[model samples]
Target: MTKQAIEQTGLIPRSIIRTFDRFRIQLLSGTEKLVIQEFRISRYQVLVSVKCLLSLIILPILINCLLKNFLVLPLTTNFWNTHQQQIFLNSDQQNRAFIELSQFEEKIYFEFLLDSFNKNPAFNNSLSSSNEASISNQAKNKSPLKTLYSDKYALNKLIREDIQRKTSELAVFYNQESIIALTNLFGDVITFIIIGFLIIWMKPQIIILQSFLTESIYSLSDTTKSFLLILGTDLLVGFHSPRGWEIFLELILQHFGFPENEDFIFLFVATFPVLLDTVFKYWIFRYLNQISPSTVATYHSMIE
Candidate 1:
């Protein structure tokens, strides 16, 4: 049934998929498109090299959407309707049974009162001091509802205790399938996160290569350089150590007794890699140009 539905209408259009592929290739290849061409490397190769990391991001989203649409919504609705109907019927029956029991208890209490009333007034006055004190306090209040509530409270306490004793019997009525389904959902999320972390940790170099491309055609402004460097650094962290680097930085700050939640400090920690990478790369580029200017010019010309 699911296959038929999927075949009838695809998730996304072919044209859109193609456009996305082209955009990713163009973005990642950067000014290195010329270099890639000179080296006879196919753009498809570039895409496939990072496909696992890309899948780590994409597959979970697709799975969540599919599960919610096909499994969770439909199965949960059907299960609720079927399971809850029986529970409600049993609850109503239990309520009726309790009401009958309460009525019988009230009749016995009323009979005792009448029997006591029939006794001598002197004998009734000679009751225990504790019992007499409680009766007098209740009489002073003069609220029938309060007296009724006191009786009902005792009945409710008994009912609660009964339920606790019969917990195993009630356990059989629970929806185990729903519990299992939710557990599986949680496991699926955990697996997704683990896969994401593994992808970053195992293929750090490839992920960095996919982040940015060399551009020798034009002189980039400081702001553009900073932005690109930061973007590349973010990609490096995301595809290398995932949240490990961020957590490490936060831990270090905490260890030094620095305020971990300060916005400026967090921003500085986040961008530190970008600053360091940019400076190091700039120095390398300058040194290479000084030592072998012709080679650098030739390489830039090929890229252009």
Candidate 2:
């Protein structure tokens, strides 16, 4: 039975018919416009095309740097300096900070002790000697050695003072890091806002840019396209991608001053890459297979 006859008989819903009609019209219109734009860009001079491509790529990057370094960073730094607070956003951050600080303190103390030992001639001579008994006797009798080894109370006081100093320094360091994180967050926000405005303002240029990129991609050899697809997929969603995801997640969390929770990081690492891999597979199956079946075949062979 014809769709029109079925619809007229009320066997098919009118809403479903309307929805499909609208979708069909929109899809055809969009595809026609895209094809026309591609043809138009293909008629441009080589120099004009290159200039358009370069400006599309470089201008946004340049603007992002200028906005971030000159505007966002300075403002955030000034505000942080004016009203500083040494605070962690959560208990996890606090614990992580102190654990890192403790490790740093241990390393510093160990280096200090090693330097002190190297500078002491008597201790060096005692260590160099093969006579263990003589070394023990010298350690007991020597005043310098006694001061270094036997003065537990003095050593404890020195360590206590150093710890207090380092604790204060850790607080200052944490405050500075918080400001840096805020600066990064604000910089990203401003950059995205500028990009959105540019997209609206330069709608024609944006269409030309999309056409340019599409033409460039399609012009490449099938092998090159396959290689690029393989490289991108491996980097983003392959077996080794979990470590990369972990590091990326950590940096993002630090940038937003979020607590670096291991559970959340692990969950993201496990799920996001699988989702991304599924997307890549779908793109390969849906678009690449239709557009260039040879490239899809080559990509599969390369994967094997």
Candidate 3:
């Protein structure tokens, strides 16, 4: 009864179900790795494990590069303080400033957009002063979204054009300054392509390795859920420390049953995400492999 009730509880009642429902295949299987002698890693498993690891390793690398060039090199560590001293950063003074800026941009854009429409000549450019004024008045009363399309009120149009131009300028400035766009998805593609090719050149090994990972995820899911149930119960009722995962490792004994001493809260919080991500990513790959093996195989072949 206790086990059944524990299995059924999560953040939401069906939280566990929703998580597993997305997977198209059983990731872990009991029969995946036949035991004859001691366990050994397969060729396919190594490739897949490395493939899964690139995203984890690359993102942090890219972010570090970006921060070094833009923040650390350019502004040191006090950029936040610099930005806050600017008038734009003064929240109490910003309301009036924002209104004035909006009005200025609005007037400039109205003329610009009206010129665009006139060149397009969708409407006769022969409207009377009174009619034009009425249109302008209507624009002022209308919402910002509606005002953009209006010929007489082109604030939104002008603002968009100005922003586009300025953003391009910023991009060019960073390029010239050697800030180096630290983020290029092309690197990821190339890394993956090399991996795919390596795997294709070595298929039987890759397949068995993939099968092992799939089986591992399935087995781990059940084990993880049980661990979570016990952990969550402890967290909910026990004195969960803000920093317990670091300490909890030593406390977790593979004895007959989970030992209950004092509260063991900090360990769960720290370790939950790392454990969750390991499960989630493995599941994602396993799911993709199941749904489109032909396509994936072809891709792997080409890259190889």
The candidate maximizing TM-score is 2
Ranking by lDDT: 2, 1, 3
lDDT for model 2 comes to: 0.77
Model 3 per-residue lDDT tens digits across residues 114-221: 666556432332243357766676556544334335544445555777766654554444332222212222233344555566556657655655676666644454
Q: Which run of 10 residues does model 3 get worst, by summed lDDT?
A: 253-262
Distance (Å) between predicted and true CA of 212, model 2? 2.1
**lDDT: which is higher, 2 or 3?**
2
Q: Which scores better on lDDT, 1 or 2? A: 2
Of candidates 3 and 1, the better by lDDT: 1
Write one digit per residue (lDDT tens) for candidate 2, span 92-157: 668877898788768766866776677677877876889989788876876556656764565567
Question: How accurate locally, in lDDT, is each candidate?
Answer: 0.53, 0.77, 0.47
Q: Which candidate is the best by lDDT?
A: 2
